[model samples]
Target chain A: MRLGPALGWFSRNYNYEVETQAPLQKHSVGSQQRTPIMYASLFEQKVVPVKHSTKFRDESVMKSKRISKFLWVGALGSVVVVSGLAEKVYPGKVAPSSPAQTTNSASTTGTSGYNVTSSTLAPPPASATAPSGLSATSGSSSSGSAAAAAPTAGS
Target chain B: MRQVLFRQDTLGTSCFLTSRVEGVDFERRFIAACETFSERLFELDQVASRFRQDSEVMRLSAENTGEPVSVSELLFDLVEAAMRAATITGGYLDPTVGNSMVGLGYSKDFELVRRDSADGMHFRVVLPSGYRTLVLDRVTRSISVPPGTILDLGATAKAFVADRICAELEHLYSLTCLVNLGGDISCSYVGQEVPWMVNLTSDGSLDPTSDGMLFGIAGGGLATSSVRSRNWLAGGTPHHHIIDPTSGESAVVDFESITVLAGSALDANIASCGAMAMGHRGIIWLRGTGLPAVVKRTNRTQMDGIARPWNGSELEFIGDWPEELVQLSGGVAC
Candidate 1:
């Protein structure tokens, strides 16, 4: 009965944590193919906990390392997000580095709220190198040609 | 060499001009053909536009005196075409659904039509009939509809324009060609081995020009009826332009978009709209027609009964598409 106060103090002072981690993954080659600016979500999925621990370190030292790591991740994430936005906002500026494989057929499925901003008559940004994503029919039986002449169709 | 041109022409829809001709001036000739094509579409709009109060069709709806009045060459042709469409579609593609359109808050031009009424006017009930009351006096070159009927030829007007102009352009320019008004595509480049390939996409309009599905068509026409856009909220309920004559309300089709390829743009347009108006039964009707088509629903893509890996290339048509377009396999007799 006398030990109850001591137990309560220990419980309040210590942190018990269980973390379920999704496996760290690299962006699929298909995902990376959409160049000029790739979506931030691509990297968000790849986020790996660079470091984790229960062992205590010098308070000042731990804080400094954490700050540096936080800054690094934040800066990289920001760059990815900003670049993706830039590529999308001004898609016409860049050549379609690759015929990006759309998440869904925009024409058949009505453009949802988030994608409305990217839907435009402006052609896909021009890319100097052949952008990746066009291999939709690569493994499949179909041969998807990049230079296939589509009839000049209108919206 | 194959060449393509895109233009925003008459009928308030984007027009695609596809040319495949060898030896010379394909680009110049294609542009000129589009110019002529656009002017003709404008003229047809003036004569057939129900949105224009002064147009012939609108005038008829506004002043249905019921007296057999002399009709113009265009009006008579349009009326005949409308009746034919209604007949082929078994009233599924009713031209007299104009009142239903107005009742659902699309009374005037689509752009001019208010999405929501200030008075909170809306529809939640079945509407009355209009097509059954129309009377055409072929002998006298006149037509009449019941007093209350609103004759909107929209169900088939644009298709007729596409069909007419496509044929005109091919013969006039002496080149293989295609005329795409939004999704209503009329093509006639049979001699060229390579068919006109169309991939329907939607940016926001009824038919977006981005990604959907690719259709390789030769000699015939294709049309798409998608319920994604040109819709609004009425009484907090969603309403669209495609109205079912039987229900007297906007159709409740299972598919998000239906694209049909028929012997003519008119037939393709009728089948596409009729499929939308018929709801799920539209697919059955299309199957009966045996025309090549692609229907994209919210979850699945389907086609007519046939096999895959058609015509050499590795491409596989997603649906049950046939190897080639059938003339009419036990289809709804048009």
Candidate 2:
């Protein structure tokens, strides 16, 4: 295929072009004739700008690959940090201690033992009392009249 | 000091809000307090009512895929309260009795259930799925239940709301308030000289002239759970609302009603329901807990050797239940 016109679109869009250098020639000096030392031939050059379309496509592929690599690394790092924090904070899989074990442990430590452990997420009752916050009506009042009264019924 | 009263129908029962306020503008403060209480009750019904199709609980039940569904803060707290009640009551007052309740022909409102005839209705004994099977994630504020496992919070939700309303009233208005939802009552106040008078009745009748016990409470919660008032017939057999999770049947106790006092209305309700479910052992259990309670046994005499030897109706008071004030023909005096 005739590549130049076929890849004309790439050149127009990317402004990429291949340039060829003239071959090295021998030059005469005052004492001796010296040949210009060629470090690398045009073909042997690392970045040989051959075809505009091919170079542009290769560069685009390389750029995408770099971005994808960074993305994968970033995603893996996020997973690691999240999982570590979750393990430390929640520990959802940790089995609760049995009542007997808790009591025995407390007894061994010379602490007051209870049937149920105090380490729970349940909020305490609204009253100041521990288990049952119920108390009797305080003081005897013969003068205080009933402000409002309601009947007790099961519903 | 001026006293104000507010009444509304809620949760298939009557809710009464009584407030004692000092200073001027008593009417405005009472109205504001009532509005707050009403709003909270409405929110709770939207979140916790099992009969309502649009409620959060019914929605959760519809999603029976055995997956955790995120719930609102109100519902999360309510369900958490139910779980706490179950834990404290040792599974006697279990929320997992929803299936049992429906199986016993109480699928609708109590009034509707009463209107329907139970001639040909077949009552099945549906055992509870157990509260342990329930999975609640506090961090995510989500709940998960096994497929076909329904949760009914009737045993504790009303009392929980009463406590919530009393607390909200005290915090918002700083007024001495008494919140009574059905028979679940909660009183909130700082320093008050007079205690709120309560007439204890088992037959759902609120009459000062009737021969009933009148007591006083300054703080905490007071709740009454009666098997007598909410009873209905199912296929020639009678059943009540309180279901024993062990048998998945109506709790048949010797007691006609049990009234309890606790630090919070939720606790009082739990204890009362638990005591009713425990049957004859309820008195012993209440004594162990050291909560003031009054248990009234059924008036009917049972057959010999069938159950506890019933010697007619008896009123048994436990702990430091206050002295009952005599109700005279004209008025009630201490």
Candidate 3:
């Protein structure tokens, strides 16, 4: 096989390509011999530190689990605290008129700074105390004679 | 079902009427009618009444000379009625006479006399600037008249209200209704009594002696206009507000009061007022309206004219009214 084609095939098969190659050096002796550095000190330095780092990573993992548990407990505690306060604020009816009413009551109770007055147009209820400044109630007794004999003639 | 009673002071009289209808709220309906009447009266009051500050008569009295302003819908109706009456009576029932009456010393309404003083009395033969110059445009509701046309719809306003109220009640309530505005009566009810019982007046009081003599009026309205009830002496001369448009003086008519029954109270009132104005022609003009009428004080004898409905022979003359039931305002004869 040709050297170029075989090298290309080998490079293609292995997915490797060389950008540049170093030039071969001629030695004064019969041949120049190359030796690789053993690097045992670098290996010792990297390996020991990696084992200590793994132990530290295990401690960080334990800390993350504790933090997640704390967050979950805090969320549940907030729900219980709000519901307890709401019971005192809003004494809601068990059987409400509609879903809209339920939503309104819930919203009204939770809102801390909002209050609304009811309608003023209606005649105050019989049992309820009349509002201030309104004329005192005169019952039907006052209108007996005039009401009975009125509208007698047309002109 | 609720019943509504409406009461108001208007058209020179107090009006009281009741309405009971199913599925209707009383106050709303009653108030609506009353408000409409008030609004219409307010508009007419400006152009028709001698009273009220904004009345056309008052306005003219203030300015003395100004072009007759554009008339409103209410004013137009009143002016048209008055003009027609003036024409019918040949100018006996003149509308332009606030100055004449005031000069005659009867400046205020009869109801407003609080111990009448002679200080305001000024008797001068001040003539009313005749109704001929007062031009009306029905489409625009505008009136152009000569300066100082003191228009007063004393009789006509009552008649107009009677007609208007009857028509309005029939439309809104879907029931037979009647409106009697100070004896200018109109009705919508049709029943066994085809001709309604209408009383004739002698000097603004019920003609007790001629009550039975007067004919019955069915379905239509009856109105009687008279100078007998409201006459007083001004500056040592007898003066009445019903001024004759021709001489610009009070009419010296043969009849004390003329009562006419017509299809509407407005027609009756106008005809009666016209009769008072026309002197002799009033009777003939009233006959033209094809309604029954009764005229008292013609040669000191009550001459009653019943329309085709009532037989003249059958209507017997009744004697003086019972003492207990003598009405202060003459109209009903016993």
- Top of the candidates by lDDT: 2
The model with the greatest DockQ is 2
Which candidate order results from sorting by DockQ in descending order?
2, 1, 3
Residues B50-103, model 2: lDDT tens digits: 776777887887776788988887777677777777787778888889999989
lDDT of 3 by residue, B1-334 (tens): 1223233344344443333333344334544554454455445444566655666646644664455455445556666666766665556666676667666665555544312534334477888887777776655656676665566677567676566666666567554444555556665534221122333432254222332322222245557677755677656677675777677778777666666655556666766777777776666665665545555554443345432222232221112111111122222211
Candidate 1 docking band: incorrect
Q: Judging by DockQ, tell me the better candidate of 1 and 3.
A: 1
Q: Candidate 1: which stretches are off by over 4 Å?
A: A1-148, A151-155, B21-28, B114-121, B124-128, B202-209, B299-334
C-alpha positional error of residue B223 in candidate 1 after TM-score superposition, expressed in Å: 0.7
Q: TM-score of the second chain in each model? A: 0.83, 0.91, 0.75
Candidates 1 and 2 compared by TM-score, better number? 2
Q: What is the DockQ of candidate 2?
A: 0.05
Output the worst ten-in-a-row residue range by lDDT, candidate 2 chain B: B301-310
Instruction: Assess each model's interface with DockQ, reporting 2 decimals per model.
Output: 0.02, 0.05, 0.00
Model 2, range A30-84, lDDT digits (tens) per residue? 1111111111111111111112123443454346556656875896798778767
Docking class of 2: incorrect
TM-score of candidate 2 relative to the true fold: 0.67
lDDT of every model, 2 decimals: 0.53, 0.60, 0.45
B125-163, model 1: which lDDT tens digit per residue? 546465667777666878877777777787777766676
TM-scores for all candidates: the values are 0.61, 0.67, 0.54
| Per-residue error (Å), model 1, residue B289 | 1.5
Error of 2 at A53 (Å): 99
